[model samples]
Target: MEREQLIVKVCGMRDAANIESVAKLGVDMIGLIFCRTSPRYVSMVDSLAGFMPNYTVNQLKEMKNPSKSTDIKVAPKRVGVFIDEMPQTIITHVYNYRLDYVQLHGYENRIMIENLRRTIEPDIRRNVKFIKTLHVSTLEDVEEYKDYEGAVDMFLFDTSCRLGGGSGQKFNWDLLKQYSGETPFLLSGGIGPEDVDNIKNFNHPRFIGVDLNSRFEIKPALKNIDLLQEFIQSLRK
Candidate 1:
């Protein structure tokens, strides 16, 4: 089969302009950081507030207490990035944010993935997609997640960091060629403007898309829109 359409995901976005820029690229999705420890954490309730015009911020605000309501309307698919959070906290955010997907970026296991899938699927009206992120330091590390094959919706293979993904570090791309399994995955690592041609040459049926972060930045939480647009447009055949 031909490679799956590369999902150009612009993660860790904070402001409306960055969100708009990423959306304008027609990227598959944009991420909002909630982990308070991340510098990219979108702390400005005011900035998130600005999205009210294009989206339903009031609905997001209501998600403050899940005992009330858990529905919100937003565009480009709202993804919440979490790292080793308590299950209740994840559930509460899932309900409050009305998130479409929850990304497990920390040291979570098969049980955690299975338990998360069970906890939310029954309570929510719609199916919640789960993305299990793996931070690879070596090929051996990449081989470990074969057990979760059927449990997640997608696999996000990112470069390992002292903190994790937003660390903007990169690893060996050739190592991905060794990934032998049926699961589809995303390519993320010190990928930047220089790697587009190499990406086009990457021939894997499961190569879904590229996740762009630090390398495409003008600053933390801000993406260089023009550069992103140019890069995305180049992907067209």
Candidate 2:
């Protein structure tokens, strides 16, 4: 299926103001790192729910608390970026935060993603989406994951490294030609302010978006809003 518009996701958002700033730019999604090891981890916050925008009361009534209220000015979809987290722990965040998407960046297989998603509460799970990350170093790295085609809502292709992604390095973009599956993918890694023209020129039927992280950051978890605004404006046009 062809997407109406390409997705522009700005990941690793932690600060309350920074998150609001990026959301105001009208990006499609905002990602928060749940992996503790990453310097951009959002777990340090006093309350994750309070730090993020509130989910509609209609979705999960019990998860809503006045103390958890935030003033994010835009409605970008919220995504919890996880690295091999337990099923129960992930389930709790989905309930507590009402995340719209769960992005998995690990060695998890299709079965793991499927089963973990099934373990979520039915009402909340129905509103959630899953994005599986593929650290691409070689063509086979993507070609071999054909089974994930239907299991995930989307796929993220990033430079292969020990940390999974956020290496601020680009892999051989041509390696994507090997993938001919139905699942759409987001191109990430080393996407900086200068890549707007290149990202626009690149084309593939399944390419649906771009994921920005390290290159757009002022620090690990803080994004440069001015740079982001300029880049997003250019990419969208």
Candidate 3:
């Protein structure tokens, strides 16, 4: 497949400068974590375990806008990561952040996913995509989510850990060879600069993209733009 055909998503971004820098690199999607327990959570906090600071919806809006100093146009879709949040809360945040996609990183049932899709306004619903995260330790784990093929727009394969994600650990990619379901998936979990060669060797017709997070971060929610740029360039080459 051509380099442009592969979608690239940089997840767990919070710092505005870093967000814009990555966006300028032409990533296909930017993920902002909404799960409170995650170190990369984007809401009302400046540092790890700090007091809840007030954040206005405008912060999200600002990130989407172009920088005044440059004409760099960032066209990446904004994705919000949530963990078992209520349908209403998801819907509210979707609009508030102007998210183009919602990544469900919790153990939500089919009913909950359907309810979320049905509840969002038709206008927004038509454009928004839903991604269901599957924590994989075995091939059976991938098959178990087959029922959600129709409910979610895509599947994210992440390492199974005590916490939902940001485990900074990788799953067995060979396990995905057993996935027979037609749903396309984004390969995530501990993907960093060093994985470019392994990623290039990974061949699966249904593998549509890759999501990078913890491994590329200078700290939680702060990505190393230089490393990310090199990774992106390597992928293109």
Q: What lDDT does model 1 reach? A: 0.77
- Residue range 1-237, candidate 3, lDDT tens digits: 354467899998887767767877878998989888888877754434332222233345456753533323556788989998888888887876778899999899888888788877485555788999999988888887776988999999999999888888999999999888788899998898999889988988889889999888888888898999999989877
Model 1 TM = 0.85
TM-score to true structure, per model: 0.85, 0.88, 0.87
Q: Candidate 2 regions off by >4 Å?
A: 1-4, 55-74
| Per-residue C-alpha lDDT of model 2 across residues 51-145, encoded as one tens digit per residue | 76443442244346545544433478889998988878888888876688999888778888888777773755665889988888998888756
lDDT of each residue in 81-116, candidate 1, tens digit only: 898988888888788667788888888888988988
Model 1 residue 120 CA deviation in Å: 1.0
Worst 10 residues of 1 by lDDT: 66-75
Descending-TM-score candidate ranking: 2, 3, 1
Ranking of candidates on lDDT, top first: 2, 3, 1
lDDT of each: 0.77, 0.82, 0.82
What clash pairs does model 2 have? Answer: none
